[model samples]
Target: MKTIKGNFIFDKEENKEKIDEFKKFIEKNKDRKGPLMPILQEGQNVFGYLPEEILKLISSKLNIPLAEIYGVATFYSQFTFIPKGKTDIHICLGTACYVKGGADILEEFEKRLNIKKGETTEDRKFSISETRCLGDCGKAPVVEINGKQLAHFTKEDVKKVLEKYK
Candidate 1:
């Protein structure tokens, strides 16, 4: 990987290394019964997310249809096609959080981050997403960033909260 003018670009050698790793994973699981799911899971583990390029490689290596592989990938919520940002912002949208104005908080984050839920910012510093619950209803309208929860935050206080992160 090479960063050119503040952008991280994967060069040809890096792509080859990544594909080689994927091939090793395929070789390990190609003969197992019901290997596609495991292969995909391991691929996700190795690559963080399954892009079309990697999926196509897997399909070709396993002799499976790309459409079928995509169907499986889409069916599972755990599988994400997009890469996660360095900072993960999980805004709880559960009944408790929403009742306490979680929606407004979510909107505030979207406005500040300039990206909708499930999107990473261009700088890759932040990724925004909504969750059903963070299991912290006592602190309704909770926003968890990078596994740490900031509880009882209001929309008016969002800027202050984001300041600590930046």
Candidate 2:
């Protein structure tokens, strides 16, 4: 296994296979009218997150500048540079949730996990993110862990919730 950019770990053989897969995808899509976005999206899908090497490969293959690719990737919130942890934690910061102490719940998560929003723990056990809404405003201050919603969440519940995952 090899680690790329000190964050992504992969088996050398597996990485080669993914690179080959991405290369084929690029070949099929490179000549499309607007190929960059699709290629970047597919690259992220292939690698879990877009690392520098993959971006550079896309640039080289498409004859596009690396900066242009980075610009496009950064402009969209849908794309992330860091890989998500095995467990994803999303705290809703919608109007209702934020008013109901959702921000405080998020702070508690950061403190407990020792990682800021949009970051994964060093061990990659958990990643924390914020969502505009969870569509259950009636149960304000919601926290979704691994796609399971915990509605009406509070800071005090953080420990108990985390313990369940542990």
Candidate 3:
């Protein structure tokens, strides 16, 4: 039906071989009753993220309830249903960091990126977020870029780090 973002769009001709492979895997594991995770993992790897249609297809193929499939996916934080940006910026909002201008840093990031928390830029390069703590409160006002942490920064420091993405 309607095309959905962060979801699967079927292409029979392009995916024929892969779909056949998945069918085999499902059939082989049909009797085992624990193939859901493996199937979803593989699906996410192939598709970058698990879409609703793909989950349904998986549930139907495995004879697992759709609710269980969805529940499992939603239960795990490791599993991402939405497509992720190339670079992730996590600004800590921990108490130490907060007083040290964490909020201001976040605000500056929003102003520069022109995207709010949980939103990916149109180019899909930057995904700015706020997190509770990065476990380095001593380095108050920390900003993590693509998993690397830089702490004890000023507003200018935030700007310079983000400008590299452009």
Candidate 4:
């Protein structure tokens, strides 16, 4: 229960509703066969991210050990323990993109946003991530801002591109 940055502490009044919903969801699925994964996924969908509290609830309600829940969550990249930002910036770092200065584009984004890869900005306005591939290597060095692809990106365009989000 140590405080981890970005994971919502479920004790907040605002999170009560979400916590209740998570409990209900777990209860509804408790009778199903091999329900842990689906319950975890639904909890993430409901809460936006799988914070510690939600996992604890799932584990307690399902009669599964906390370590087992943690193990399953960690095994899947689809489950993020931390909260995502308002805008998710995915910079491609695949072989094609990297060969074409994608790494430089990623660095520029980190510098401009003041956050390293996989970290969200303090204001929560943006999260910078290094994506394996954006599926558009033809336009190598592709950047996706909030799921909107920006192909053939350049460092000079960084300021202008970010300004649009602001």
Each prediction's total of clashing residue pairs, residues at least 3 apart in sequence or on different chains, is 0, 0, 0, 0
Q: Compose the digit string of candidate 4's lDDT tens values, residues 1-166.
A: 2445453344446777777777888888899999998998998898777878778778789889999999999998888776778888888999999999989988998999988887777767888888898899999889998889999998888889789777
- Tell me the whole-model lDDT of each prediction, alpha carbons only: 0.83, 0.89, 0.78, 0.83
Candidate 4, which ten residues in sequence have the lowest lDDT sum? Answer: 1-10
- TM-scores of the candidates are 0.86, 0.92, 0.71, 0.88
lDDT of 3 at 125: 79
| Model 2 RMSD vs true structure | 1.7
What RMSD does model 4 have? Answer: 2.4
- Top-lDDT structure, candidate number: 2
lDDT, candidate 2, 1-166, per-residue tens: 5656656565447689889989999999999899999998998888878878788889999999999999999999888888888889999999999999999999999999988999987677889999999999999989999999998899999999788776
Full candidate order by TM-score, most accurate first: 2, 4, 1, 3
Worst 10 residues of 3 by lDDT: 1-10
Q: Lowest lDDT 10-mer window, candidate 1?
A: 3-12
lDDT of 3 at 73: 92
- lDDT of candidate 1 vs native? 0.83
Top-scoring candidate (TM-score): 2
Where model 1 places Cα greater than 4 Å from the true spot, the runs are 1-12
Q: What's the true lDDT of residue 140 in model 1?
A: 93
